[model samples]
Target chain A: MQPLRLGLARGWVTWRSVNTTREGLANTIIWNALPLVFLLIFRNATIPGTDISVGVSLLPGMLAMLVVFSVMGTAYYLAAEREDGTLLRAKAVPRGTAAYVVGLLTVAVLDVAAAVAIVLVPGLFIVPGVPLGDAGMWLGLVGYILLGLMACVPLGVLIGSVVRSPRVIGGLGFFGITGLAAISGLFYPIAVLWDWVQWVVQILPLYWLGLGMRSVFLPAEAAALESGGTWNTPLTIGILAAWAVIGFVLGPVLLRRMARRESGAAVAERRRQALQRV
Target chain B: MATTPAGPAIRVGDLRMNYGRHEVLRGVDLEIRRGEVVALLGPNGAGKTTTIEILEGFRTRSAGEVEVLGEDPEHGDERWRAELGVVLQSWRDHATWRVRELLAHLGAYYAPYATASHPRPHPVDDLIATVGLTASANTRVGALSGGQRRRLDVAIGIVGRPSLLFLDEPTAGFDPHARREFHELVHRLVDDDATTVLLTTHDLAEAEILADRILILAGGRIVADGTADALARQVAGRAEVRWRIGEEKFVRPTDDATAFVRDLLTGPDGAGVVDLEVRRTSLEDTYLEMIRRHEHGDAAAAALEPAVAS
Candidate 1:
């Protein structure tokens, strides 16, 4: 219980430190605004053979993209912190690792929320046919975001623990998430891709998250454009929940293994290698 | 809490560590009592860091019976961790965090472990002042100078008011002024909290000033263990006595400097003797001699023994 309280305090302090800085603010605005600019450019363009504008369809996909990016960002931070000795610092204290994990999770959630809101607020006014007054739409939005975080945060931890280099996550990870997005149908429909590609994408969390978002944001008529030609709410829920359960179970084991290997010698050797690269 | 465990703060017997075929620690043994400031001095790759890491429970030894604060470090729990403070060499962790903010956050973890006799955390502002970072209390850690950063590291290490502290090369990169202040800080921690410190350093002078006892580790074993004076005596067991008779100078090494000086003075040249001086072997000289003997596979290395007076 004490560790939890301290963790909460740690989370708030870390979040405030990153968000309040000038460089942090600038970074947030630039990355989040890219998706918005794309949405605006396609505001008037309608989906093929449908009365729905591409902008409205792209909004939900953009939100899904933000969710996926949150996972990658979280993973990157974990790896970076390990390299910089922050994780070891936590280990040095009593229950400090628990606090450190809680702090990181808090930051990830807050980051996703802020990024989503930045695009959503302006998106509401710019796009058309969104059910602004529908309580169901709002509830679904909140539910999907919560589920998405639960599913993705653990995966982030697992990846961060497994990967030795933060640069690998920062460099290759960006392209990997972007590539996953391309196939997951965030920008276009998944049905248009090859059958095997669609099957592979369906197994991953990104496609399910995008589907969940589109089901709530787009009108009921828009379901025809989906791969199954209908909104399979149960399948979406089951797939995302499966990911969440799997990640929660495996994440801690890998994290503990990685942490057990951490010592001053390891950190110093890493620092020496990092400096050599520079 | 009143009935604290009655034993040495740390005890290790026949500690051995091997990285595959490479043996780092081979049959190392030492003991540190409560409130004792012991310094581990060794050349690079003598398994100093490995030995400390094993004691801190950060690494596992291949074979040994090790105890820290009465429990085997291999199985020490969070309560055990709360009682220990580790001051690692910092590179760039918590860089964005302010000095005061980081300290306060870390100190909160110890609140539950606080006892009547030993308070959990030293106060944030007071800790800041103790490490001489009060001016940069609110400053970002990344913005601090090298010396200031190390000061913050020490502040963070002791923030929990630990009973036992581990400092691995605490003043490695420090300048003279910073080193002096750091030595003073260690003294204050020991005097105020009775914190038993186990620090590893290559700086012999530092070991001499801060350590209640010094242990010189060479060839994976404690070649010498005792006070600085005792270790120096083990290596040479003689002091140099010098005197000038007119324009001529005389130098002699003897087991009893007092007797040698007395004999010289009472002899024919007693009245003529000028600029008389006596110098015992410095710890640096003793350390170098021990290391050299050990490297050359000399049997005398084992003869140095503990030399610690009971």
Candidate 2:
């Protein structure tokens, strides 16, 4: 319980630092710029069978994208921490890693919240009738966002634990998530892709996250644009919950293994390798 | 016997560490009493860092019986770890945190471990003042200068008010003034809190000034162990004695300088004696000679017969 409380404090401190820092705030804005512009440019463009503008339909997908970015952010931070002596410091404290993990998760949640607010605030003006007045709409939005985070953040930590360097997260991690987004129907409809590709994308959490987001914002008829011509709410919840459960199980083990190997010598070796690279 | 229930703060028996086929530490054994400040002095690659890490439970050893705070370090639980303070060589890790904020955050971890007699974490302001970082309390960690940063590292290590502290080259990059300040802070910890300290350094003067006992590690073993003065005496028993009889100077090296001086002063020529001087070997000389001897095939001989401080 004490570890948990301290972890929350750590998270709160880190969140404030990240958001208040000029570079950190600028980085978040710059990352969302491309997607925001993409939606604005295609605002008048309709989604073929529907009268809704492409901009409004893309908002839910952008929310999904926002959550996915948190995963990348968590992984990048972990890699950077490993390179520095931050992780080893955590290892030295009693139950420090447990608190560190909790702190990291807290940071991820707040980060995702900030990302959503950045998009959603401007989104309300550009996109019409976002169902803001409806209680059900708010529930869907909150539920999907929570479930989506639960699904992605742990997997990101798992990847971060295995991968040695931040460069890998940038090169392999960024490209890999972007590729999933491309097929998961975030920017475009999945029906346009090959059936097998759609199946592969659906196996991932991003697709269901995007779908869940669309269920909350898009009108009832928007379900027609989905692959099965329905919300598939049960499957979305099931799959996302399954990912969360699996992540909760595997994430700790992998993180522990990664942390157990961290020592002062290891950090020095990494620092040496980093210097040579430069 | 009214001794403290807690056993020796640290004890190692036949500690050996190997990486692949290369052996780093070979059959090292030592014990440190509570509140004692011991300096592990050795050249680079002498396994000072390795020995400290194994005790901190950060690395696994090939073979050894190591106990810290009365528990085997390899299996020490979280409660056991709460009693240890470790100061590691740090790069820029918490670059964005404010000095006071970071200390407070770390201090929270020890809140639950607090006992009536021993409060777990030191108050943030007091710790900052103790380490001479009170002026930089609000500054971002990244903005701190190198000396200030090292001081912060020390502050963080002691935030928990650990009973046993491990410092591996804590003042590696410190200037002379900062080094002196650091030494003072360590004395304060030992004097006020009764914290046991095991530090490693290449600075012989530091060992001489800070350690109650100094252990010279080489060839994967402790070649010499004792107080700084004892080490010097053990390594080189002879002291140079110089005297002048009626402007004619004479010098001789003798194992017993007192007897030699007494005889000379009382002898027939004693009346003319002047400018008498006896110089014992410095720790610097003793350390070098010990390392030189160990490097010159005497390591195996020393390893077979370990030196335990009496």
Candidate 3:
């Protein structure tokens, strides 16, 4: 119980530092700026044969993509901290690793929240016909975002625990997430893709996250652009919940295994290997 | 001096550690009494860190009866862990955290384990002052110099007020002033709180200054273990004496320098003797000699009694 409290304090400290530090602030800007620029470029352009502007349709997909990026960022930070001996330090204290993981998850949740706020607040002004006056739409937005995080964050942590080095996370995590986003229809409609490709993307959480976001943001008529020509709200919730269940069950076990293997010499060896790589 | 209670802070028997087919610690044995400062001195691959890590419960041993604070280190629980403080050779772990903040956060884990006799989590301000990092209490760890960062590591290590502290080369990269200050800090801990310390180091002088007993490890075994003076005397039994008579000089090794000097003055050649000098072997020489003898498989050197045996 004390460890949990300490973990909350740890999360608070890390969140404050990450948002306030110069490098951390810069990373947040660089990540969100690229998507904002893309949104502005297509603000006036409408989807072919539809009253919906490209910006309005792209905003929800962008939010989903941000969830994926936040998960990848969590994994990358875990691997890098392992290389830098932060995890080993945690392992030394009583119940330290438990606190460390909780702290990380807390900070990651807050980070994803900040990112969502950054895009959605500005998105209302730039995108035409945004349904801001509806409180129900805002509530749905909050629900899907929360559900999306529950699915993605644990999977990210599992990958972080399994990967041997930070370098692998950097190259492999980036390409893997980007590849999933492409097939999940983050940038375009999945209905326009091959039928087999659409089926493949449906199994992943990224697609459901984007679909749920679209359900809240896009008008009812815009549902015609979806693969099934409907929002399929029930399927979206089920798939995301299923992914969350698998992640929560598997994430803790793999994390414990990884934490058990950590020692001072292991960290030192990793640091040595990292230096040699440069 | 506030002597430690009548029990061993750490005990190990036939401790062996093997990585793949290669063995690192081979049948090593040691016992550190409560409140005693014991230094593990060895060459680069002498298994100092491996032994420390094993005792800290961070690594599993291949074959051993290892006990720290009356519990098997491999199975030490959170309560057991709260009593043990470990100072690892940290590089850049908590870079963005301020010194005081890190200590307080790390120390919070020990709050529930606090007892009436010994309170857990030393006050952040006091710990900062104890390690002489008061000025940098608010400074981010990344902004600290190498020496100040090492001091912060020490503060964090002792924040829980551990009864048994394991410091693996705490002063390795420290400058002379920082090293001296670190030694004084260690002394204060031992003297004031009766905290037992087991540190590893390549510096023989540091071992002599900080340790009540020194264990010389070579070839995966403790070759010699005793007080600094005791080990020096055990390995080299004599002091070297040199004198000049007329244009010739003579050098002689003696078990008793005072007696030898008196005998020389009383003897026939006493008047002619000039420029006399006596040199006793330092811990450094004894350390090097013991390591060399252990490597060469000398039977007598390996037969010396350890600190616990004495």
Candidate 4:
């Protein structure tokens, strides 16, 4: 709960940075407008399960994917800011680092919240026969979303601490998270993979996030037809929590150490080395 | 926590900093009083910026005692940081933020600023005006010119109303007019607020314009420390008085040019000086001499001795 509260604070600060003025507001509108793109292209595609509309079938997965992408982007932006000294300057402020980190990760919180709102509302109202009304299922959805977002914070800090190039942030960020997600079954089922790949992905959290979302949103009949006919709810929650725990416990320590070691001079030296290499 | 004001505004004694085996700063001693604008003048890799960053609590010293605003900068906290301001060379781009609005947000971070009189959050307005950014106050940082951006950097640095400011090559990309204007603002800021300034610059003219005292660092040591004019005299030695007398141009060292001119010109008839120009040593000439002397020792002395005597 404390971790959630801290994450909430981070989310709120990112919101504040974005909403501080009209430009920020516009940026959010542009970012949140992503669902509109989904509506235009894949909104009418054939359903994945049963005879359900593709818009309805892909909605949950799209929501989960958007949340993951937004969360990862927030994490990477923070890493970039830290690399560029903005994070260090924020650390020098009164509350020290925890507050500042939460502030940067705040963007992801807004992203995930907007994504969840946009995903659920449309699936609930516009799409016919989209599942709802199971209290346990709703609980599962909230749990995974919250847990998934929590995991992003530490990963964001880790990526920020390790990646030094401001320009490479996008490449490193997309490749790292998307590559991990590809095997984890966030966008598609792991059952489509080779036996060796399935075994490998079973060890990842996104597989559980995707699995957890499917178990909650899909009709129980559809869920029952695949993957042992039961949601790995406990396993999904536990793995996500573990990632969050590792992120929380180690993230700050790593960030502080990285900040202490890195400086403007370090960046200049790295640039010199890069030039020499070239 | 103790606020008796006993220690200097900035102090670094025997400070040594290194990256790997390459020592950047070695045995550097520095002291800056409150309200004093001390300039660190040196060539690139001369450890000027390193010393300033260490004092600003942005960099850790490998060895030495550094007390900034009566606190150990290496172990400084938020309160210590609040007492000082730093103008970094550049800023990151935020696509949507206007300049004034951005400064206002940064000002809100300080504890003192959470008040009533600055109700609308116009703290940075005067600083914006101070740095000559009134026209660009509404401009986004992304849209600003290099000189304008640097000015905004200065405005942001001083927005906290800090008692001490660390400026690392503040006027680097500024034009001549902008640079001169910045110096005036600096002088006024120092006078009005007693804001202790520690500036690092490659430009000697900028140092001479803004610094009350200058420290020339080389090989991570303070090779010369004095007021700009004083440093020039101390390093490059006496002025040379040259006069065109008849066919030959005669050059002689003079401690008192007024008295020397009377003896050289009026003492003898037809030995009257035609083209007499008294030249004093410049900060640039002295700085080069000091840095060269620090590196080459006696070899430097041999070259500079005859040049100074003439």
What would the per-residue lDDT of candidate 4 be over residues A1-278, giving only the tens digit for each residue?
Answer: 33334435545644664576677567556665565566556555655546645555555665566556654566567655654556555544444355566656666666678767865775566555555777876787787788878876576677667766655776765686668766766555567789888877776566777777777777666665445667767877788788788888887787788877655566555546556867
C-alpha positional error of residue A259 in candidate 3 after TM-score superposition, expressed in Å = 0.9
The weakest ten consecutive residues by lDDT in model 1 chain B span B301-310
Cα deviation at A184, candidate 3, in Å, is 2.1
Query: How well does each candidate superpose onto the true structure, as a TM-score?
Result: 0.93, 0.90, 0.92, 0.84
Which residue segments of model 3 deviate by more than 4 Å?
A194-199, B1-6, B241-277, B295-310
State the local distance difference test value for candidate 3: 0.85
Highest DockQ, which number? Answer: 3
Candidates' C-alpha lDDT: 0.87, 0.86, 0.85, 0.69
Question: Candidate 3 falls in which docking quality class?
Answer: medium
List ranges where model 1 is wrong by over 4 Å: B1-3, B236-279, B297-310
Give RMSD to native, each candidate: 3.3, 4.4, 3.5, 4.6
- The iRMS of the candidates, in order, is 1.1, 1.2, 1.2, 4.4
Q: Which of candidates 2 and 3 is the stronger one according to lDDT?
A: 2
DockQ of 1: 0.68
Better of 1 and 3 by lDDT: 1
The TM-score of predicted model 1 comes to 0.93
Total clashing pairs for each candidate:
0, 0, 0, 4
Candidate 1 chain A: worst 10 consecutive residues by lDDT? Answer: A11-20
Worst 10 residues of 3 chain B by lDDT: B301-310
